[model samples]
Target: MKIALAQTDIMWEDKKANLDIAETFIKRAAEEKVKLILFPEMSLTGFTMNVEVHGEYYETSSKNMNNDKSHWNFNRTLDAIKQLSIKYSINIGIGYIEKELEESKGKNKYAVISALGEVISNYTKIHPFTFGTESKYYCGGDKISYFNIDDFKLSTFICYDLRFPEIFQIASREAELITVAANWPKARINHWVDLLKARAIENQCYIAGVNRVGHGYGIEYNGNSLIIDPLGNVIGNCLEGVEGLIIAELDVDLVHNLRKDFPLKKDRRESLYRELAGEIIESIH
Candidate 1:
């Protein structure tokens, strides 16, 4: 399948402008016959902590305006994106802050929309960036999610989730390609690139890391969005400090063949790891 990573420069808390930019990228990707287009974390809004502005309401109407806040105006943007995806006949993966009716707080979520305008997979970020104080405003998700597109089994994870390999290991059990949407800063960009390669190498799957460029919340981002194959080779990259699309074709057979040849997962000692973890927990108690 052909996939495109949109390394965008998010307008700070400006939904309409960002929506327009996102559409432009989606259209360009469609012209290349890309099957899936991915955007960075908080694609519409620069990583802002102000929930009142960027947070979505539990129940929102595209026509109704409860207030003038950007959060309340997200439904309209979502509707527009859905229409664009249907019009272009392309799948889309975008990130946003979603508010649930059952909970008072919102969660960082990545929504995967099919070409037919159907929401096939909605994954909330399991690990919020605590160092950035994201945990203070958004609730963390508890589980990972996977979905399929034709012959490819795909999964998604947010920015900080890349640091945790256990979830990737679990997802790799069923997923051939994994997508990561991030708002990572330029200061730690080396870590981002290294971890992405590590995850792909360790899991024997394709990894796509889509990150943003430009400055946000007083921090600058050097877009190092990348696509790595199972052998940890970078098939495509957007490079640093550029707002553009990086396209790559992924082969599912490569994943299967590499896993079969390496057979690393078959030798995992899960029982030993669990016992050691239990012992550590007991000692802490």
Candidate 2:
């Protein structure tokens, strides 16, 4: 499948401006006839923990964990996906803040919507950086999710989720492509590059990591968006501070061939892994 990754500059804490920029990119990708286009994490608003300032009142009244009746422009993001999909006749995946559940103190939730404009599934970030009150502002997602688009099985993950390898494993079991949307900074560029390739090699799946560029809340980012092939090669990438579309063609045959040759699934020692997981959970509890 041909997918276009948008590596663009964000409008810090400004939802409208970021949406405008994203729209322009999406239009361009459509003109190029890209089947799927991805946007970076928190694309509507730059990564900021000021929930009180940016968070919206998301309730059932919103009809889909979003209430546009309250003048929530962020809610329009969902509509944008549906409209874009219909207009361009392609699938689009973008990240945004959702309304919170009652048990959670935070009003913001992180979610990824599909081309049909339906929220295929939503993942509250499991690990929130405590430095900027992310934990206080956003609820955490408990489990990993996977979905299918045409012939390819795929999964979605936000920033900070990359540190955990097990999550990738969970998705890899069913997905041939794992798409990670992030706001990762320039300082950890190495980690981002390494992890994307590692995930492809270890899981035998294509890895598409879409990260944003520009500065936000004193944090500067150099968008190193990448599309890693199943054999663990960087096929397409954007360098530091560059903003544009990184298109790559991913073939399902490679993933199938690699898994058949390596057979990591059949070789896994689940019994030993259960014991390890038990020990870790016990220690945390």
Give the winner by lDDT: 1
**C-alpha lDDT values of all predictions:** 0.89, 0.79
Q: In order, how many clashes per candidate?
A: 0, 2
- Candidate 2 lDDT over 103-219, as tens digits, reads 344423445455566666555666776665777767677877767776788888888888888888888989999988899999988999999889889999999999999998899
**lDDT by residue (tens digit), candidate 1, 1-285:** 999999999999998899889999999999999999999998898787876556663334334545545534345445666898999999999888776434556789888889998878888899988899999878899978899988899999999999999999999999999999999999999999999999999999999999999998799999999999999999999868989999999999999999999999999998998999999999999
> Clashing residue pairs in candidate 1, if any?
none
**Prediction 2 TM-score vs. true:** 0.89
What value does the lDDT take at residue 271 in candidate 2? Answer: 90
TM-score of 1: 0.93
| Model 2 worst lDDT window (10 residues) | 100-109
Which lDDT value does model 2 have at 225?
96
